[model samples]
Target chain A: MRFPLFLSALFLLLLPLTAGAQTKSINQFYRKYKHSEEVFNITVPGWLIKLGAGIAKSQAETPEERAAFQMVKKFKKLKFMVMEDHNLVTPRDYNRLISGVQSESFEELLSVRSDGARINFYIRDKQETIKNMLILVHEADSFIMVSAKTKLKLEEIADLVNQALDGDLDNEEIVPVIKPQA
Target chain B: MKTFKILLALLFVAVGFTAQAQDDAISKYFNKYLDDDRFTVVYISPKMFQLFDKMDLNLDDEEAEAIMSVVKDMRSLRILVSEETPKQFFDEAKKAFNTNSYEVLMTVRDKGGDNVEFFIKDDGGTVINELLLLVGGEDEFVLMSFVGNIDLNNISKLTEAFEGDGDDANDD
Candidate 1:
């Protein structure tokens, strides 16, 4: 009788601790859809990210290259998923997925609708700084979601994008996989 | 020994506070919408810039050297853009600047939907530590923060380096 009471007490003691460590909503979503036929999921932890940044940093010689390499150091993990094939996933279904995604703790940072495609950016912040960010894009035939956990400040990322749009990467066409907006 | 331990604990607490204090207003905004899809986010780290510096662009000596000088000193650059009404964002940005917290470097109303504004964080001297670039209009909203060792004279030269490209930009 005493042993049974002790066991119950131990279980009660650990309950709140486990509850406090709730799994992120995005991670839960990934687990739910990971085995689905149309979903392609990729998860990379910090070690590989640091290794890649190190290799690129070794080759860095210009100001831009060095800046980019430095920024990569903040990333802790990269998670990506693409659910494609229109026959497999309809636009309405994609919208539902997006709604489900928004229902999580992530707050919308930006939303773009162009050419019948919608892209949304969301982030989870703590103490006025972002710890993780998610990007969701829905095209006619596919949906793409990318999540990054990093310590980088928002302005740093913005500067890099500005530089890119300034046409340094213009020689190569980096078009979206989605069809052009109608 | 107990006193020393307490002092060490205090030091750690202070360090933690300092780290948290470093998050600026723009960084807070960046964190707020970091994952939002409507925004195109770009980040260029110092290491990436260094990598580019190593490349052999094969330009003539003067041009190559000028480009190198500009690229070598930049610490970090980041830009965020969104295709939406940014009046609210603009107001927030202005508030974050804390009214006269930074020196107004320049402002220009460019043709079309482009209006460019520049602000600088200077420590009571010619040396500028940070440059804030804000562009706003109907088509897009942009915020660019560049932090590094900046020389105003060098910035003028940097503009000259891109003079040839200006025509190309205008054509677009």
Candidate 2:
């Protein structure tokens, strides 16, 4: 009787932890296709990202470069997956993947479809800080998914976009500066 | 134990019904075309708007301030657009939404057979809850819904801000 009682107590204790660690649907989708020959996947750790950010900050010569450095520093991890073959992901599967992502507490930030290409941005946030961001780009012949884990405040991103729109930050100038050095 | 199980089952049923009822009409219309490849959908949640309200944007410019004031009260924005069979889609959208609850704010028809209409939902006061915009032309259809406590005065100020920026650009 005491053993049964202890087992019940143990189950109660571990239940919440297991639930908390449950894999998100987006991650599950990534794992399913990441190893396929048609898919290209890359995962960068937080430490490497920080190291690169520090290096870029040191080399920053322009205001655009400085702004890019500040934005890049907020990212903790990044996962990129791309597939060029249209035969790999069926339309039904794509729809299911989208539904699954939405069910996982991810909210749509923006979506655009034009000239046979569709781009979607989704973010998961807690209060005023964004926790995770996912970008999905689907074209006639290719699909790309980019996921980032960050603790960025929402205002920072808005301010950056505002600056970019106001012609204060030139995106072309920022791109080369943030590129990782060999 | 049997009675407890019955009660749990009933509770689940009640919760399911409540969830179904809570889905708004605009969401239902959006979901209808979500899986269709021809349509593009955009959604911004209330949480995002709440976050925007919390943001301390240090812009001292009047234009930026005006835009921020209008943005802070917005709860959600949903947009659906399609280029395939746009006229048909536009007509279907008109039929799908019950317009009796909304007041027609503006309607513009250009010489090119393009139609643009604006509708607002309010509680007989200056505060608006939802603003719906529909555009249908020969090649494109667009339906946009902005939901929140919207002030017409603030929106007019935003337009003025845009006009001011345009004038500045022209001067430069």
| RMSD to truth, every model | 13.2, 7.7
Per-residue C-alpha lDDT of model 1 across residues A1-182, encoded as one tens digit per residue: 99999999999999755533333566666777778877888998988999999889889886567678878977888888897774244555555655655555455555555445667776655444457677878777777878888776656665554454444445346644768899
DockQ: which candidate is best? Answer: 2
Using all chains and alpha carbons, the TM-scores for the candidates as numbered come to 0.44, 0.75
Candidate 2 residue pairs in backbone clash: none
In model 2, where do residues sit more than 4 Å from their true spots? A1-22, A85-87, A113-117, A155-182, B1-23, B165-172
Model 2 chain B lowest lDDT segment of ten: B18-27
Query: Candidate 2, chain A: TM-score?
Result: 0.73
The digit string of per-residue lDDT tens for model 2 on B1-172 reads: 9999999999999988875553366788887876577887777778668778887665556787887888899998888889899899878877665456667889898999898888788888778988889999998999999999998899889899989988986996
Clashes of 2: 0
lDDT of 2: 0.79
